[model samples]
Target: MSGSREEQLAAWTAKTKRVGFRQRNWSVVRWLAALTVTLLLAGLAVSLLDYPPALAAACWVAAAVTGAIMLIWFFDPRRFRARPSGIS
Candidate 1:
């Protein structure tokens, strides 16, 4: 509780990142699953509300693309590593 702000932040970041592989994988799975369900619900709601076909399809495509990007980004190994030098 007495460290400089940068020291405190580094300690916190290290602590948060100290999970085992299994735990990290589970966390990723849960995150993606929740996003999938939310997107599904939104898509369904849009369709039920009788939005124009193009609009509804666009919404679904956007949601799907966003989710795909997130999934890929989440599993990017570089993100699990420590920050590079000069990066605060």
Candidate 2:
């Protein structure tokens, strides 16, 4: 019985191993990039429209930070980690 349980668990893990993880990560990166671009454009518009310099600077800074995070997530070496046994 113990052997059978282990086998079943192994099969289940194999079936679901890293399922949707890559898709979800890519989706997150896409959204982050979009947000960064939007912020950057907003900053540019604000500056062009003669808005407060501080506000425009804040927007640009936020865009830079989000862009950095997106790049980091995209280039990270360790992408996936297996779930602990019996936790799924």
Tens digits of per-residue lDDT for model 2 on 68-87? 99899878756444445656
Best by TM-score: 2
lDDT for each candidate structure: 0.68, 0.82
* lDDT by residue for model 1 (27-77), tens: 665676677667767777889999777776776776787678667767877
> What lDDT does candidate 1 reach at residue 43?
78
Alpha carbon lDDT at 75, candidate 2: 83
TM-score of 1: 0.47
Give the best candidate by lDDT.
2
Query: In model 1, how large is the Cα lDDT of residue 77?
Result: 72
Candidate 1 at residue 79, lDDT? Answer: 45
Q: How many backbone clashes does candidate 2 have?
A: 0
